[model samples]
Target: MGTQAPSDYSSSAPSKMDEQPEKQAKIDEKLQRQKEIDDWLPITSSRNAKWWYSAFHNVTAMVGAGVLSLPFAMSNLGWGPGIVILILSWVITLFTLWQMVEMHEIVPGKRFDRYHELGQHAFGEKLGLWIVVPQQLICEVGVDIVYMVTGGKSLQKVHKIVRKDEKDSIKLSYFIMIFASAHFVLAHLPNFNSISGVSLAAAVMSLSYSTIAWTASVHKGVQADVDYGYLAHSTSGTVFNFFSALGDVAFAYAGHNVVLEIQATIPSTPGNPSKKPMWRGVVMAYIVVALCYFPVALIGYYTFGNKVEDNILISLEKPEWLIIMANMFVVVHVIGSYQLYAMPVFDMIETVLVKKLNFRPTTTLRFISRNLYVAFTMFVGITFPFFGGLLGFFGGFAFSPTTYFLPCIMWLAIKKPRKFSLSWIVNWICITLGLMLMILSPIGGLRSIIIQAKNYKFYN
Candidate 1:
């Protein structure tokens, strides 16, 4: 009868309106907690940095001990290939760095502060983590280890200069320990922004030492009957040395590994996005990079020819005071470089501890974790301070992907330029070249390591 009085079912409609707010509250709570965690983390803890901070930070990041080795890298490659590759690397890396900065805030209202975060956005979440974390860790951790060796060797150079008549009894291992002690104190700094002063000083030191290196070479003039021939005689040796040289060049163009991390420090607004200022800062840094890299590589190579030591400073024995100053600058620059590279690894370690392992974010936790990390890298650096081999090895193996091709791949995936378009063609070209670098350079580096290791003793 009349559909059972039309069944008053409004209250029983099965709608979730009543439960929606409650569920939303839980979601909000979770998000808030995560934000709190991010705020406590090293990377996202501060966002007050200016554009100039980016400039010096990038300079500090890019121009480190690697610049001192550029001439040696050139010696390995010879004139034609060395100049071409050095210039090519500079252009390619700059383009990729631009891609990274553009992609940092590619998604509206979000920022991929870390390399892996952007990787996650481009690739699927799990796959992104798998792709980026291991590679990023390898690049970052590898740099720390290399810089440990760089800092130690630089300190040794300084000591040799200052104590000219000394017996040279102290081992490089001891110098590495002395260098690691600086990081033990420095690693306690809170975040990227906290270390800006150190980074600025390091950047200045980089430019200064680079200037001294090349100018000193100019002053010294070309070696008597200078030979521009390949350092190795055999074809196989030459090929491997060539490959290792690629790694050294690749290593010279660092800072790509930490570009996004540096960008994360600057405050971003919707109207004036972070990319603009980031790009400006990048341009400044690259100019500084060109100034520091080209002369050091070319002039140093020209002055020494094929006889250049793996570290150019090691080759220069004259003008003792200037060499000592350059060596001291290396020490200071690498001090900042080591910390810059280590910050990401520290972030990773602290993240896992606090979030994954449920450790409290206490000073004691930080003290222990950071100190242990410095100690671990110190141990490795001491064990094998094969600077040239390490430069080539880590440079090509890890750096090639992050610096050379990964950004291009990410750009292609995200931007999706039309087939055969300029963007498409360029990205592919970079990918191909980067692939070659990754495959070839590490082989040379490994061979060099083996040769060095044959007569090497542990921690000597």
Candidate 2:
């Protein structure tokens, strides 16, 4: 048999041995595959693909702006009514987020562009442009004021920390310059991947200080006996008081646009669609923010109870360490707010200098814009010692779109008016109510302003 096989092997005709090259090639391919398997043996799939980002977006949005406004709110309604308002705001905010979550996922690219263009798609070009133009301007600019006023306050704290006497000399020009410049620098750079750590840090500090302050106040038994019982009994109670609370809630809960901005910055993928990322992040951010804000309000109410000032800084009777930390945290919180505020300032300048006038946006524009913003900020800070009016004004008019109106419109645009979709209806109610409240908040704000005027009558 061996000899026969050998004979066949030597024969000129093809034999089984002729298949060796092909077989060997197949074996070689198998070996290469095995080698690749071996090389990739330690490769592990990511358990938390978006873990950091989710946490970051959620925490930062909550801590940054929410903490900035909570204490002031606490002073207005007392802990009981303030907490109720915060809860109501969260409800509306959640409703909006539920609608937005679906829209964000269905079409993920160019969110701002798409959102702006929706009116043309759903209503018509005229309506689309009309809706977008005002909303964009208001949302951006209104948000800008939030950052400016709050950031100016924080910066003033820093300045006060360094210069005790210079407190009176807090120039709007300087404050605007600082934040505008900060925004200019940060806005030009790539977005940072991790904002949660800083956000959480701020949250912890804000909560800790407010919590401690409230606890101490409770221990001190400084209950503010504010008699707003007439508010509930008045003919204008529902229109003014209820609506005002709702508007304040709306203001405190604003900032969904920042979520849209985040959605635009990320790379699009079917798996990483923006619906979950954008909407969930916002809802969570608001919830965390509401929770944080409620506590500050409740505790601040309980602590200072009725004696709370617009800038809750006035209510503390703690050690210097606590005051210093609270003040520092306020500064950090303002810095975070400044990031959002700068967007409007930037857009305004760009519209005037570049978009309208056909000039280029350069470092110089950045500098000029920021300087102008800082100037405005300082003016607001100095003139409006009471934080309540600033919050109310911004919240009533500016934040309405971000909090109540836009999301409803956005949902209507994306999902076509389905039976389950009541956002637009709800938002319309909120808007109608908000418009009413806007009328009255200014009344309350005017009341606040008048009180401030009286308090500063000596200055005049």
Candidate 3:
């Protein structure tokens, strides 16, 4: 045929360059919405994790223990001892975070998904598994125990008000079942934005209660005379003691996973090998946590001053106000726990049922099954009355290794020998010391478990 004029097929040809910005914008908006849905718990990207998310993660992680453990520390030691422990934890955590930030710089994005992966990249796959897995498990169990105990105490108080006649029916088993079920249900649902609000409020209320307790106790000169010889016996005392303390500290600082989960939701910038310049954000979040925790630990210890009970509420001078605020704290605490546990349980169920059994998790039947799992967890915790013991048992043997030691080891393993210099040696020393603490912590914890076991009659 003759050379005919080329037909104008530019409109017909598929070309991204020809798409209008508005049209592109609309498509991008749809994609972003779809992405949000696809990632139930988003990943923490370099950008989206700037402020609030990081703050929420840090505060939530620290609050669980500050409320419960501070009192225990104060009871065993004194205000002086409790504050010293808090300070020690703060220092160690700061050092760990600095290294963590450096590690993040190396791995860039989404490298810390399993936590163990960090270790695997650093030391070797085998060692990472051994350390990170147990450490994470322990940290998780500690959180579980803290929630169960606090939740039980709260429900008991509320039952007194709502169902005086059937008050006895609101047994620990009932509360545990209810709490566990609540977590399972919440976790299954595709909603978690509410968790941060509850955590922040709980933090505030916790601080308020600590302040009031300090005022009451300090005026009486109780705060002035408190001792702190417990440091000599604490995990920081030696390698073994330090490892145990590290386990406890891990409980005190386990919120990083929440941010890590959220990060999965964000769009990762490919080839951007830089650290999430939001080190400031992470620092600020941790600073808030340290501030909240330090005051509460100091004041609570000052107030109770070695006489504080495991439950800080019981030690408050004002029983009425104490019960009210404690109930609030406990309620918020349970809600927070529900939020935390829900995701893990749901993922676990989905993995087991859907992946292993090849069944979908979105169906109504699957949903019911998830709820049943939660119910079972709660029921066992409450009925057995071994919530705290179980937590300590698991934490001592697991959480310590996972959070503190694993991360350090992971860093050492992942980074090249060229990068391993004086700083690396210091990190290794800290990790070694933390491991030692993990070894000896079980002794004190097991003893407490034994003591508590003998007091079943008193607990009832």
**Which candidate tops TM-score?**
1
**After superposition, which runs of candidate 1 have C-alpha atoms over 4 Å from their true positions?**
1-25, 166-168
Error of 2 at 52 (Å): 4.1
Local lDDT at 390 for model 3: 42
Report the C-alpha lDDT of model 2 over 422-450, residue by residue, as the tens digit.
Answer: 54466567656545645556555444446
Model 2 TM-score, all chains together: 0.69
How does candidate 1 score on lDDT?
0.92
Clashes within 3 Å, all models in order:
0, 10, 38
Worst 10 residues of 2 by lDDT: 40-49
Best by lDDT: 1
Better-scoring candidate (TM-score), 1 or 3? 1
Q: For model 2, give the RMSD to the true fold.
A: 13.9
Per-prediction TM-score to the true structure, in the order listed:
0.95, 0.69, 0.73
For model 1 the local lDDT of residue 194 reads 94
Task: Give the Å shift of residue 96 in candidate 2.
Answer: 1.0
TM-score (C-alpha, index-matched) for candidate 1: 0.95
The count of backbone overlaps in candidate 3 is 38
Sequence-dependent TM-score of model 3: 0.73
